[model samples]
Target: MSYQRRLHPNLHMETDSQIKQPSGRWGQRTAYTKAPNITDILAELKLGHRVTPVFAHRSYTWELQKMLRARPRPVFDLCYLDGGHSWDVSALGVFLADRLIRPGGLLVLDDLDWSIATSPAFQEGPETLGQFSSDEQQAKPVRLLWEEVLPDLGYSHFAIHPNLGWAIARKRDTKAVVPAD
Candidate 1:
């Protein structure tokens, strides 16, 4: 008998990981962005056979939802959501991750208070609220998800690890029923 573990569709990928180098000339400026592209990261990390890497460059509904529809359920033990900063996008990720994560699985969210307008961490954006005032920046999506959404979704409240700017939650156990004679 042989057992082979398959990479989830989200992590499986095939790509040409060659990024063109820049000449750094006046006409040919630097050909690099602040963040490395998905293919670049995959090649750098050497995650070829371990998992599938789905670059969700579009709306969650369009990308994640379509993927979920094709793949089997309860496939993931942990999901880290840190890409999108808006409430709606984060909420969508959480909802979808809920279906993908197995029972007793863990879900982690990043950027407890990470809006460009509200966060003091970024100096370039306009400050809607006072910087480092109430720490309301921490409350936007992080608190709303941890304090409100998780409990409603049958996930136990885990500590929001502030140092790493993440909130963790675990799927709760199902209620047991006693047999009646």
Candidate 2:
């Protein structure tokens, strides 16, 4: 996170190249203060040893490809796609997860069966869908994708039951099997 320069030809995420894993409790604070910001804290404590955290603030579009192309590293073992509850965004997340998640990795999907099917008459109240626009009203349930679509794409719901419409899917493992002579 140190500094994210939008989507570019490269990830453009370099923190003075000063990445290290300092053992201790990492706190959130400014750079000059005693506490370290989430960016530096994660860089040092989480991935400083041998990994990199590629964060994107914008939508998951073609920029994902550019980010992958720029960094040469092992596939991630876990990925949580928390974009909007629309089919387009969910589909895009699945597509990206397929490429970024390593075989046998876990891909958690949020907001399953969350259509919130209420008539427009009931779509009032500031606490409800009144805050969103027309497009947001079309936010459909994602369980259909997880149940009907993702299976065909080489992913399956984990053994654990999906909690509150949150599906835990694992990528199909493609491990190599050694044949005995």
Candidate 3:
């Protein structure tokens, strides 16, 4: 949210996430901040009118699926994906977001270097061990998507910032036509 604020101050952003404090490591941290969700931060900053917050009742992936089903056409110029870093959640979410983003729009994937094995929150969990293989746990899912998925989807001007742990790609401008020789 702060990054979006800094990048595009006037942009009216639609943010989606589970309303409750998250279930893992961040949930414990939220107890200290008292800002359980984005809603609280919006209230504190008084940016409610500028930013639309959609709280997911089920999960972020479910909410994104709902958005794709309900919306008739692409609505956002920039789709910033920061939720659901795992392949199970993110792959589907990014695919849906591709449809949600308008032509010539930007798709920003955050935490490109993130992986279950490296994440302190999930590294020691039995659930993580069962769900992800050793390679899957170590694999950078977002970076994998950036390289393997987005290129196949035909997005242009791909930029990867390893140090910053994020990547950006632009949906092709469908309206543009090439000149014949």
Candidate 4:
């Protein structure tokens, strides 16, 4: 969620020479970090009268499963997956989101454009079928998988936020049939 950079002073100065003092904060103190912007989503959820936060990491699915299993039912009102950029990880995230989200819940995927629109492996083979053109392909599998999974999950309403490469998917209460006898 955050990144820090460090800078060191040059070591070419002579022992008797006066070294230039660094301005403002020094060393690690000068490092800066930023938090992801989730304020609007949090506010919207509050307005909708929902509480409880279910945080899941795409790369840490096992840990997530363990945590969710230890908790009560309807664990998450909204799930956002932005950890793993790989197809396998993203797909697993979608699957877990389906399991965790209650009827009428919401799910969000972050960095979708970067992951899907630039991965070489995803531009070929099983990852790419009939959905997008060669020039319009994305590197992440979620871009393609969501189309099939959302409807199957009974999410009737979905919207993509302009300019943020973020998408919001809403699960509906429509009865979904299992493909079995």
TM-score-sorted candidate list, best first: 3, 1, 2, 4
Best candidate (score: lDDT)? 3
Per-candidate TM-score against the hidden true structure: 0.59, 0.54, 0.72, 0.53
lDDT winner between candidates 3 and 4 = 3
Q: Write the per-residue lDDT of candidate 4 for residues 19-105, one digit (tens) a residue.
A: 112232222211111221233334544643454333323235665667568746445678766545556666776777678787778
The better-scoring model by lDDT among 2 and 4 is 2
Q: List the residue pairs that clash in candidate 3.
A: none
Which ranges of candidate 2 are over 4 A from the true structure? 1-55, 116-139, 159-164, 176-181
Q: What is the lDDT of residue 86 in candidate 4?
A: 56
| Model 2: per-residue Cα lDDT over 5-124, one tens digit each | 222332212212121112222333222232343356556556676555444434454546675675684478887665445667668767876788898898877656555344333344
Per-residue alpha-carbon lDDT of model 1 for 1-181, expressed as tens digits?
1112322222312222222222222221111231344445546667656656554433444555775787454367777766455567677878887887777788887766565455443443334334434544444776687788889999987767665567789887555464699
Residue 61 alpha-carbon offset, candidate 1, angstroms? 4.4
Task: Give each model's whole-structure lDDT.
Answer: 0.58, 0.57, 0.70, 0.52
Please name the candidate that would achieve the greatest TM-score relative to the true structure.
3
**For model 3, how does the per-residue alpha-carbon lDDT over 1-181 read when each residue is reduced to its tens digit?**
5533544322222244233232333232231233335665567678888766565554667777777778475378887787667897889888888878888899998888888887766744556466678889889889888889987887875687665566899998788796899
Per-candidate clashes come to 7, 0, 0, 4
Between prediction 1 and prediction 3, which has the larger lDDT? 3
Per-residue lDDT value at 29 in model 2: 21
